[model samples]
Target: SNNDYNYTVDLSDKSLILISINYTVSETLEIPSTYLGRQVKNLSSSIFVTTDTSNVKTLILPDSLTTLDNTNIKPIYTLENLVIGNGITEIPDSFANYMNNLENVKLGNNVTKIGKNAFCGCARLKEIKVSDSVKYIDDYAFIGCSFNKVLIGKNVEYIGDEAFGYFDYILSNKGNSNILNPYYVINGYSSTAAEKYAKENGIKFIDLNNQPADTEQTYTYINDLVAGDINLDNKVDVNDVTLLQNYSACNVEFNDFQYKNSAVTHYITSITINNVTEIQRYLSGYIDTLEIYSVG
Candidate 1:
């Protein structure tokens, strides 16, 4: 009576199952749709922990699968390409930890939450496109990645704490210069908040606010601040030197001296005269003053 009787009653009311299979699978794996007459709805923890699927490069999750908890599953150390089905809503933490060669990821449209440290330490990952269904991103989701670009979808509303922390590390770290200008395009309808966040965190924000409007041009302006010319009359000559000497000796006060749009409120440090003959005359007068002081 193993195949007959009330097997249907037991199978229909079951929510979880733990089964062990002894089979050797090669490089690529496709989870079969029908397993023991019931649809493979979810994966149990540590299901592939001891399985020798080290050579597997691509994993195709079943469409009916709604949850995947990596608490017991062995890390996919050799997986470079991963394809998640659209039915998945959450990606487990530490999902991409040991995937050193993983360079590209395509997330499903039904995904709503990305676990913390889900994609951390993926140094070779260059690009990622989050689907429109994503609503929350946990901390350090993309930490320590060398990716220079990230394209967020339109429906993404919240970028969690330290969600872009790795981007700040790439920009501030003096040791690594290869991670330059990583973000080129961010596609979303709520781009204003994204732009503000980018600018506040030192990332260049390309204003994509216009649909039919053309891109705005950027320009740089330079202004120099120089001292010694109190009045800023353009020439550092005898008149300027006399003015400086009088100001320093307290004979004349800077009641109205203003330069470069700011009030000259401090004492002048040094004066540079442009005329050679005037400099010679000023030195002779200084020598005469010293001689007089020595004799007196």
Candidate 2:
């Protein structure tokens, strides 16, 4: 059923985005998946926030969703459950910052990044699962949170400052913690970034890999190629740029991996080399892939 809401599309991409919704909304809602015959892929910060509508107890996202803008996520005063669809690649900046009463979050498996302040100040959040594909978690993303259990995937490469740590307010106010398991304990594999982070912050760590491997989503790859390495040369150079240019112009077809990977790789390496134009070109291609939701 289509919940009453308004939207605006990105003219250049035909991507759907929700702009507003009426205040008279149901307590539990399944946000409409389509608008104007196109699948809605991006959600604005206010679309389902508790500040905008306090009646929302659960917000079910669409599988078409790829982006959730959290730059201005007002507190979810009453929202207890949130479902992130599998197409989503990242939870954008401030996605759930200051949602002081949130209790549960169902993150998608495809998500790779958790933006800055994504879940900051969620004091009542008791459990969260960082999907296996996630690689980055930004600064203050979970500041002041008092989660009882947090399972970080093996793929995680970085965790930013003040994330999942004692925030200024948390320290001063002396919040509640799991009594039997007092300090924070990140459920992750030993020697992984999660373990390192836990060690540095005096947080506890639990080894997840000791369990049956088949039962878990293993993202730790023994051999991984760097992005933008089109030629498999282990470096992003002018030849890679030329290859991308040729591929875009339809002068070449991919013999390496897929064009999407090549394009994304090109996009990542361009930033280091200061190739602004090439970076923008490849970045657009990469973003286009993510926006398509179910890319065929």
Which candidate ranks first by TM-score, i.e. highest? 2
Supply the global lDDT for candidate 1.
0.50
Which residue pairs collide, candidate 2? 227-265, 228-265, 228-266
Off by over 4 Å in 1: 1-19, 70-74, 165-187, 191-193, 206-296
> Backbone clashes per model, in order?
4, 3
What residue runs in model 2 are displaced by over 4 Å at the alpha carbon? 1-3, 44-52, 70-76, 170-182, 211-296
lDDT per model vs. reference: 0.50, 0.62
Error of 1 at 65 (Å): 0.7
- Candidate 2 lDDT over residue span 1-296, tens digit each: 26456777879788878866754667776766787788888777666443355677777787888767542435446788888788888888878777765777888879999999888767677666776799999887877566545788888999887676444231111122111213455788777778888887767677887853222322211024344555656665667777666666668765322232343432322222323244445545643321101111
lDDT of 1 by residue, 119-195 (tens): 87676666667766887777778765655445555566667554552432221112222122223333334454445
